[model samples]
Every structure is written in structure tokens, then in C-alpha cells.
Target: MLTQIQASFAVNALTVSMAGITTDLDTPATSVGTAITAGTFAMAAFILLGAKVGSRFGTRGVFQIAVAIHGLAMLGVALSVSPAMLFIAQASSGAVIALIAPALTVFIATNYHGAQQARAIGFLAAAIPAAGVLALILAGWFATTIGWRWSFVLMVALAGVNLVLSFLVKKVPAQPGLSIDWTGAIIAAVAVILLSFGFSGLATWGIWLATPQAPFDVLGISPAPLLVILGLVVGQVFFSWLRRRGREGKPRIFDLRVLATGSERAVTACMATMLFVGTAANFLIPLYIQVVQGRSSIETSFSIIPYTLSIFLASTFVAYLYGRFTPRLLATTGFIVVAAALTLLAFTVRGEWSQGFVVAGLILLGLGQGSIVALVFNTLLSAAPKQLAGDVGAWRGLVHNLSGSVGIAVASAFAVGMLSSMLLAGAQEHPEISDELIAQVNFNEANFLTNEQLAAVLESRASGPELDAAIAVNAEARLRALQISLLGLGAISLLAIVPATRMPGRREGDLPEKLEPDDDDVIDPVDEKETVA
Candidate 1:
């Protein structure tokens, strides 16, 4: 729990501090989004390798070393003076997380069984939201009162605690004859990196049309969309390469057998969808509070507390409900709840911070998000064989980090794209502002500014009528863009209903079939308390 909490703390803590980092570095929020997405991308890119490496070395040793490295990265982040420095630091932190991710899951599987396993998984899963709540409070306070850089000091502290806890864990023997598939790993890494980078640049490089920042154009169209397409193609190639290796009797990066079943695939899909919503909310809410409202990270934390706590509670409680409800039913209901919450938020967000309305919507969102997050993971663990726990961990890391990266990328792109378009439209409506002013500010790539920042810029450039008109247009555009983005999130929530329905209709306690060839490897669905291994 300490290790898991430490990892979750490192990432979510950064979210609350994003506004301060951007301001201090004189960079845009999108750049901070890029840094965050880059970290996730690095995780997705190397997680499978980390998984296989753990089996080759030892899970405990590798995990402990990774934790120490992660702490050092946090220390690096704490002293970062530039966005580029922060980006590199975050990437290093992410790579360390990749090493630790799979080992943690393996540790759980090796240590417990059946009911104890379920409870253990519940604790591990709940640690994420619980840590988020704690981290938000600390990070927000530090960012507001001391300095945002001090926020990483907390991360470093948590990492130290986790490292101390690591010594207490029992050491597992290294699995013999496990070899790294360098060719397949390289291909997979490239695909993931391309996909993350492509999506992250969608707004800056243009969604479909080429922009000045674009490296190159595809028949005069933006390469961003094309890169996404190419990434997908490369991903297919990577999978094919894995299959060929498996056919040749080579030691695979992971046992693809973990995802061979229909129920397993459904679990992966559900997880990805749910994470998309959760990750996007994490990014957008802090953004709304810090960037749009011009509030401190502390305010963002306070505003988000209700939602985080709900998730923490729901995730903790839902693990025990596995025998009582079907995964399909729980997931479907969760999606509907989230959809409703998002719809409410879409209509309720006003120009001014409507705390009551937003909190109400967030409470609803938290209930659903919390329940689904834990339930889906428990369902996945239960469906797979005990020996395939490492494989499941790799897949979990890949799906979660990849979906999170894409979610942040998509949300950033959509919000920025809308903000730019709306600002242009708003400017056009107010012809009182001179063309000279528009050219000076360059509304197309204008950074999102608070009222104070806008006022400062106006004071330096223009006075009276022109300044007032610019401020009015900026305010109108910002509000409208936010509303539209919330609507988009609501629509996405509704779309998840389709995948939720695809989950197997079996009772959560029922096993579909033997997950492995040896009968000893098959967990008995009847007892529900016996060790499968």
C-alpha cells in the first residue's frame, strides 16, 4: 500500500501544481500538459520491458531500486527552473514507475489468494484515490503558501517511506529462462511514443490543417493526425511481431495469453474507457480552477476534495460487493451515473466559479468513478490465471498509462482548439478593437490568461475602449470554450455505455473457464477462499 500510494502521489501531486509551474516557467498550460503526457508516454513505452525485467531479476529488488530512483526524480522536479527541466525530470520519474508497476502486482499475487487477494487488491486500488486526496491537500497548501516546488518535497518524503517499507516484503525467486524480446519491445515503444506525441501536439500542430509549429505537412494537411494513424498501424505490427515470436517458441515480453479470453478483453476495454474519463477529469478540473478561475493550487485542491474522497471511499467499499453484483451491471450503472454528472456539469459551469453546481456534479462523478475503478481491476485479476499475474500487470500499466496519456492529450487539444476558435470569433464580433491590437496579441496562439494578466497586457498595449473590448471578448471566449469542452466530456461518458454492455453477463464470482493448462493453476470458483497456485 505504501509503494502504491507513493507512486500515485508522485503523479497526481504534479497535477495540482501545474498552474504554478507554468506561471513560474513562463510557459503555457498546454506545455505542462505535454510534460504530464510525456511522463505517461514513457511509462507506456517501457512498462512491458519492466515487467519482463522483474521476472528475470527479482520483483522486490527491482521495485526498491525503482522507488529510490523515483525519489531522486522528485527531488529533481522540486528544483526545476525551466519547463524542459521539469519535463525531463517527470520522464525519469515515469520510467522508474514503469519498473515498479508490474512488480507490485506480482507481489500481491504471490503473497495472497482468493478472499485475501480480493481485499489486498482493493487496498492497492484504493490507495490511488486515497493518496490523491492527501497529495492534493498537501500540494495545494504548499503551492499556495510556500512554493509549488515544495510540493515535490512531499513526493520525495513518500518515496522514502515506501523505500523503507520495501524491506519488509518477502523476496520472490527470479523466474528462469525469461529473455527480453528486444525487437518487439523496441517496436512497441516506438508505437506508443508516436501515438502519445502525435495526440499531444494535435492543437499546437493543428488537428487536420497544418500549423506553423508542425514539423511537416502531409499533402498540406497536418502531420499530427497522420502520425496518430501511423502509430496505430505500427501498433498492429508490434502485436504481429509478438505473435510470430510466440509461434517460434521464443520467450515473449509477456504472455499474451492473459488477454486471450473474451471477458479479459472486455475488462481491458472497460478499464481504458473508465480511465479516459477519470484521467480527463483530473486534468480538466484542476485546469478549470487554476487557469480559468485564476485561483491558487490550494483552491483547486479544496474544490476537488469532495470528488477525491468519494472515489477513495467507493473504491474501498466496492471490492466486497464482487459476490453480490455482476461486473457488467456495476460497470454499466457506473457509466450512466458518470454520464449524468457530466451532463449536469456541462450546463452548470458559468463565467464565474459556481462552486455549488460544480461540486454537486463532481460528487456524482466520484461515486461512479470510484466504484468502477476498483471493480474493473478486481474483475480483471479474478478472470486471469495466477501465473499470468505479471502479464496482467504489464497490460494494466499499458492500458492505464496509455489511456491516461491520450485522455490528457485529447482534452488539452480540444480545449485549446475551441479557445482559439472562440477567441477569434469573439474578436470578430467586437470590431471596435483595432486590427493592430489583434495582430499584437495574436489571438490564435494566445495563452490563456486570468483577468489580472489580461489587464496587465492591456495596460502595456492599449488604453480605454480597446482594452475593455479585449477583456470582454477574452472572458466570453474562455467561458464558452469551457462549456463546450464539458459537453464533449459528457458525450464521451455516454459512449462508454456501449463497451460496458459488452462485458460478460456472468456473476462476478463465477469463473468462465480454466485460465491455464495445468489444473493446479486453475482457481476454484466454488470455494472462493482457496489459493489457486
Candidate 2:
């Protein structure tokens, strides 16, 4: 479980680091485009397929296959020469992750008893940020010094380690009479691809509210809104068809009935909400550090170290808290803390001491998000039936990945819109400035702008013009853009509070008391089987 957890964490960190790499290697717009759309598609496809494969081949087989695929994908990414190739590589990696994630969670649930299961899941959850810290630190340093390509090479090494560890995994017996639902898989894939593409288009073209002047148009007839509508229609039809198939006793990709349980529903909601907030923060913070604070990639990564440590520490503490306190309290408290952190951050955006406040906010947010993630995973495994563990785990992972994709998409759109507005307004106010100079203000490369660019802009200004005034206006616009982005993030965080409230309150410490076991139950049948196998 620990090895699998570590491997998953490494893969996850590599996946997230793609966003930063996109910024370093290409334009922000293109980076967001490739990362969000391709990543979403890859993840959704992987989840759907992983569930089927796990049921047919067993968790161990799925794990081994995924590890091999992941290694190959990393190697491909390291050698990628174009954006298309990179996206393909990332998609492959995403699929491998989808296969391994749920299997790992189910493995723990199947192998361990109640409280031990929670602790194990908590450890797995903690590994996410722990691995992220390592990846972020290394990615920043390596990208700054050796180039972004080397960072992908580093992932190849991690993937190699994961592949080697796969050999140590014990084989799991597959469930009898299970079969793949190819029809459902096709439908699900189509729906996911359509929806992700639609959202990607919206993110690029700008949502209606964000760009009201740009009317809806599909190939000149408002393509953005139309595509979004089409995606929704397709998704609804797909689900309706699945429902009919289920009623007719035919195989379905997703068993909607499994989601009827309170625990399942609550855990799914918590996972989605936590991931939404966590990923949004991850997407936005680095931009703020680089653009607004004028920090290098290495400096920004270092600045985030405290937040990463807090997440790891908080996740570790969650294992101990699980049996002692209800998930409800922990999850709710986490939401509140995250929301508070965002609100506090809103107040310090323009101050000279903003970095300190930002750090504080990140720490608190990490603490809350980390705890909620651990709780959700533990609750998910506990709630799922043993026989359907793989399916349940796959479903949970799907929710997490989908949430992350949506979060990144929404956050990127919001940040870009906000920044664009700021730039436009600033330009209008400073009509004396040349449009050429305004165009040269690369928001994405704000941290690494050449002195020549600044000098050219300054020299173009009116004679005797106050240089401080120009600098102040530009700085103010950038700060305001970041502030607006953070506000949007806070609003998103607020949406999570209600969902988190529904999470089960069971704690690890209370599990033994709540689940009284007879003497015969003290020994696990799975453990005996494992010993024999």
C-alpha cells in the first residue's frame, strides 16, 4: 500500500507540474489549453477503462499494467518535441494514473481492518503533497537551471522506480462472471471528450458573462455557447441510455445505484469539493508569485514550501484524528479554514507584506484541504462493498480528476479574464502610453522580462513624465488582476462548504467502539488468503 501510494503521489505531482512547465516552455494561453483539455480527456478515459480492467484482471494486474504504461508515458514526455506529442504523453500518463489510483485505495480497504484502513488511506493522502513538495522543489530548480525538459526526464526516473515496485505487488483474484461493457465505455468516452472539449473552448473563447461583447457564435454563429449546449445534451442522452440499459439488466459502464448510498454520495461530494479548491489554489498561486510578487520560479517554489509542508503535516495528523473525531467536524473545519484563508488573503493583496499573508493563507488552505482529502478517501473505502471495491475506487478517482480539471479550467479562465480587464482598463487610463509598449508587457513572463523591454517602454514615454507614475500604474494593474483572481477562488471555495458538511463524521479512534468485533472476527480472511497465495 505504501509503495503504491508513493508511486501514485509521484505521478500526481508530475501531472500537476505540467502546468508550470507549460508556462516555462510556452505561452500561458497555450499551456492552459493543452493542460486542461488533454488532461481532462485522459483522466476521464482512464477512470472508465480502469474500472473495467480491474474487475476483469484484478487490482494487482491493473497496478502492474498501469506502472508499465506510466513509465513509457514519462519517457515519451521527456523526449516530446511538440505540444501535440506532450499532450499525448500526458494523456497516457493520465490513463495509467486512473488505473492505479482506485486499485491502490481498494487494496488498502481489502487488506486492512477498519481503523487501520483509515490510517492507511490517510497516509496515502499525505503522500500527495509530500510528493508534490519534492516535485515542485525539483521542477523549479531544474527548470530554472537545466531547462523544463530535464524535469520530464526526472519523472522518467520516478516512473522507473514505480515499475520496479510493481513486481512486489501481490496478485488479486478477479471477481467471477464480470465482463466489460464496451458500449457503455464508448458512450462514456464520447460524452467525456465532448464535455471537456466544450469547456476548453469556453475557457479559450471566454464565457458569455466574461466576454459579453463577444456574442454567441458557432463558426460565426456563437460556437462557444452552442458547443456547451451540445455537450450537455450528449451527456444527458448518454446517461439516460445507460439508465435504460441498467433497467434492462444489461451491462453499464457506471452503476448509478451504487451512488445512492449516503456515505458514497457524501464522500464523492467531499472529494470533488476538496479537489476543486485545492487545484484552483495550485493553479493560481504560482502565477501570483511570479507576476505580482516578481519572484523567480525557484523563489516561488520555495515560497510554497510552507504550504506543502502544512498539507503533509495535516494529512499525517488526519490518520490519528479519523477514529477519534467524526469526518463531518474535520471536513467542515477544513472548509472553514480554507475559506478564511482566502478571505484573509483578499485583504493583503496590495500590501508590501502580502507575501507573508499569502504564505499564511496557503498554509491554512493546505491544512484544511489535506484533512478533507484523507477523510474522503477513508470514508469512501469504508462505505463501499468489498466486492465492488475496485469499481467504487474508480468512481471516486473519476470525481477527483474531473474536479481537478474543472478547477484548473475555471481558475485559468477567471485569471485570464481578470488580467485582460485590468490591462485594458490600465491602457485606457494611460492613453499617453504606446500600444506597442502595452503589448510588450508579457504577463506570463513578468518575472523574466528583459531590462531592455522596460527601458524601451520608458524611453517612449512623454518627456519629463514621472517614471514612478508609470511603474505604479503597471504594478497596480497587475496586483488588481491577482486580487480579482483570488476573489474568484474564494467564491469557489465557499461552494465547497455545504458539500463538506454532508461528509460522515466517523473517526478512526471511534471505529473500534462503533464496529464491535467478535473473537472470530479478529482474524481477517484476506490476510490468511494472502499468506497462502
Q: Cα deviation of 225 in candidate 2 (Å)?
A: 3.9
What digit string (tens of lDDT, one per residue) describes model 2 on residues 398-451?
Answer: 777667767777777766666666655776577565566566555432321222
Q: After superposing candidate 2, which stretches have Cα over 4 Å from the reference?
A: 1-40, 79-87, 141-157, 167-170, 209-224, 351-355, 419-471, 505-533
- Runs in model 1 deviating more than 4 A are 14-38, 75-89, 142-157, 215-221, 351-355, 420-473, 507-533
Model 1 error, position 183 (Å): 1.3
**lDDT tens readout by residue for model 1, 11-45:** 77777778788889999987777777777888889
Query: What are the TM-scores, per candidate, against the unseen true structure?
Result: 0.84, 0.79
Candidate 1 local accuracy as lDDT? 0.79
What does candidate 1 score on TM?
0.84
What's the residue-level lDDT of 261 in candidate 1?
A: 57
